[model samples]
Target: MENVTLSEIKRTPELLKQVESVPFKLEKGKRYLFVGCGSSYNLGYIAAEMLNKNGYEADVVTGGKIVALGDFPEADVAFFISRTGESTETVLAAKALKKRGIYTISIVCAKDAELSKTCEENIELPFADEESVVMTGSFSTILYMILRGIKRYSIDGIEGFLGKSFEYVDRLELKKFSHFVFLGFDELYGLAKESALKVQEMALQWVEFHEPLDYRHGPKATLTEKTLVVMYSKDTAYEVELAKELKQMGAGVVYIGKEGDIEIPYQDGFETPVRILPVQYLAYKKAVSLGLNPDKPKNLTKSVKL
Candidate 1:
């Protein structure tokens, strides 16, 4: 039986095609804020980074932070992201933003979700909804939707990239490593974080995420032969050197960049939505190898309420 998680991941390219026609656009000169929890939070974080890099001012805050602090950043508009849209903090955060006269928009994969009701407006993509407990396709679909506002950039040869990436990861000996480290910068940093979460959630492995250079500061002390480092590089000389250093430390390394072990050219972070495809597959493959089900992650529910 094909895993539901794998099915969702594979369907992302088609989801992107569907979402591409959805007429999503962001206004210029308006401060934007994004709020969500878990994978949704990571999606917002990546969106915030991409927009800010492309001459748009944006900020991101976890729903829990806004609900706890009762203080949010100044923004002309706020976007609340939730797959199921019933996440307690996210829905509450949307309400709080609405009370402050900030326009709120819910970006959800489900129709008529609680978050959509709490916000001033909603952008629902029910077509991308998933049946698995962990988020897979929707993350990239929403991220691509947000990026499309900046520029309608299609991932050229997406299907080919997906197949090659899955094959590369599948070739690895999953049982050889138990520790996973993901490294990147800016929006890629958000991608690295999401990648780490996939491994932890699906494979139940120890995973960590850090900015590439920051790893040398102190994080490298824990490197072991059992560690597998995944670097999302910008193809910078320093980053390429860092990959070599980590490999020398007995950590298995998979570099993803212009000239990486699994070459996926960087597109100024806009490629992030596509870049995540392999790690998602890696997590699923790891889970299956360990006799675990990626669809139903242990001790987790689809929507975290309260």
Candidate 2:
């Protein structure tokens, strides 16, 4: 795991250099589309949010949607994410977009993948060729790289963030949680989803992800003393209130960012998605502690051929 993360971290500079040199135009009126599968799909969701937050009109949709929907809105660029760069739906979606004269930019780990061939430009990471069926360092590293790119931050800033995040991961003891639930709102909604997936996929536990307020609507019924709710608190006051309520309900809630009065050291505030890494790493560590191999989750594969 360390090797995978280090390799990916080491490649950040080169990845940034490549993306910086890509010849493309991002106009204000142009729409941007993000497409991927599974974890990569979740990464696309984050990418779409980042793009939108940065003043670009962006939307996230699954690769299947792109293929089935056929004609899509005219866009300046489409960002396609696929870890293996071989997901069937993603490849087909890229091909579909290309047929429509849409410029496609791929974010993949496999530089030589078929999907890469279909894309006009691509950002490849070092976290390629996973040995596990469930994605771990690969998912986080790729997403982190995209986040850095979206923020247009310098490589130094990115490296500093990565260093702190790695330290946080090392300090956490994840085996304590018997069950876990991830919560977030708005942009962090995708973060919550990815965190929940990490827990379930890496830990092989039934973990749930929900909107902070939405949890009270119906999902709260499943809460108990045994359930560990990991909440990603944003800048909104409503989210803080929701976290407080959940804590009152006897649910062990760990707030991700320092927005609310109930703060955890792991909370670095909601400005960045790196705050979610602790829980992700914890889930992986917990799985390993339980004698489970997170690299190959049960009944799953690195790439779904169908």
Candidate 3:
């Protein structure tokens, strides 16, 4: 019900600091695991990608799957992402990992949540608590924090990328799209997934996500003049070809990133921190236009009880 833009805007610095403070030394051959539920699960996906991109071996799994599988690699560290820090499956997975003597970390909005209390480290997000049933700003802010945090610690040229991304968000007319699709490859897979989730949670739209090469598959059958396809151009040769194909399908296509003919100035290299902004803006603007409070999506609370 309140303005979330300010909070989302202010979160970058704090996120950078939180990421810097974490002790990252890992034993040789040890793995890293990221776990969460729902939007938090999406965060885990992003975190895992960031970690992998930074030369760490990391994998993402839903908290429920972690509990059911009962077997994980001997992780040197595990991260649990929960906005409220109290997701049932995340808490249980954290507890299970702790019992194995692994270092557990929590990225959460609630500083004093049970998950935070149980983990060895807690990174509290700057986004305000969401009162709606669906997650909007909370999901984006936390993910932005995670990406920014990774950029601060591992990647170079992140701040410039973040600034450019913010500027790009200011320019987008996000609510104009009636239907959406996100396409990407490699690490961009996480970005596309998060982008699709943002539309779904904040705007209540089921945005489709696909691998760039796979778009030619059966899924392309749904393409129409009304469809908006947002593709991440990760400096790949296939991007231009894929964009061309999608355009031929009679869908409006917006290509993101550098190294593409349809250049999006806000996107930079594959590692640029600003890459997340367009989708974030898309979610925010769509929420504003729909008269639905992005700060609170319907049927969504800060946390799931179980």
Candidate 4:
């Protein structure tokens, strides 16, 4: 019996290919703000980092921050991201941003979502929608769509990449590991956070995410033989050393970089959508090893509605 989460993960490359032809555009010299919750928030965070790195001004704020603290950044345009487009805080934040006279755009995987209705413009990717509670393919699809808005890309060789990544994950002795840690920086940091969320959501496992160097500051105290560290590296010398250090501490390490256990060359954050796929597969495999169903995570719904 295959899980819906696995099915969705398997379909991601096709989804990316389909969305490549879809046009989404962004204007230059305009400050952009992104709003969302949970996985959606992580998506926005990565978008902001990439955009800023590319000379565009962008910032991301969690929908909860806007709804709870009444905090809003000044921007000519704001993008509200929600997979189902019904997340309560996101809708509320979109409404608030619209009220303040900023143009709002809804990037969602659902058709005619409430968040879409509230925004001045909507970028809907219904084709990327998923049935499972945990986000799999849709997350990558939406992120790819947004990245395409800035720079055109063809996800060439994605099939081979997926095949290799899944095969690598399959070879892991997943049951021996209880704690999972993901490390990265900047746009990769957003990916690291989302990777932790994937394992925590799908496998109900202990997980953590941190910037590569910051892990040594205070977090490495808990490292043990049962810990597995997934490093999303920028090919930095310091990060390379840290991987060796973590390994010496008896923690199993999966370094992801130009030369890594799972080699994924960083491409100025353009490769993020693809970079996330292996970790998604790892989480699904871990859930299966623990006799949990990744298709239906505990205490979660497809969308978080108020």
Model 4, residue 139: displacement in angstroms? Answer: 0.7
Error of 3 at 165 (Å): 5.7
The local lDDT score (0 to 100) that residue 195 gets in candidate 4 is: 99
- Clash count, one per candidate: 0, 2, 6, 0
RMSD in Å for model 2: 4.2
lDDT of 3 by residue, 119-210 (tens): 99887763445444455446645555555544443444555655665566556555556788988775577678778877777778768988
The sequence of per-residue lDDT tens digits that candidate 1 reaches over residues 72-150 is 8999999999999999999999988899999999999999898888888889999999999999899999999999999
What would the per-residue lDDT of candidate 4 be over residues 124-212, giving only the tens digit for each residue? 99999889999889999999998998888876678888998898889988888999999999999999999999999999999999999
Off by over 4 Å in 2: 1-27, 68-74, 127-130, 148-151, 154-176, 259-273
Q: Rate the local accuracy (lDDT) of all candidates.
A: 0.93, 0.69, 0.69, 0.92
Clashing pairs in 2: 132-295, 133-295
Between 2 and 4, whose lDDT is larger?
Answer: 4
Return the TM-score for each candidate structure.
0.99, 0.80, 0.79, 0.98
When summed lDDT is taken over every stretch of 10 residues in candidate 3, the lowest stretch is 261-270
Residue range 192-236, candidate 2, lDDT tens digits: 898888888777887888888888889888887777788777646
- For each of the candidates, the C-alpha root-mean-square deviation to the true structure, in angstroms, is 0.8, 4.2, 4.0, 0.9
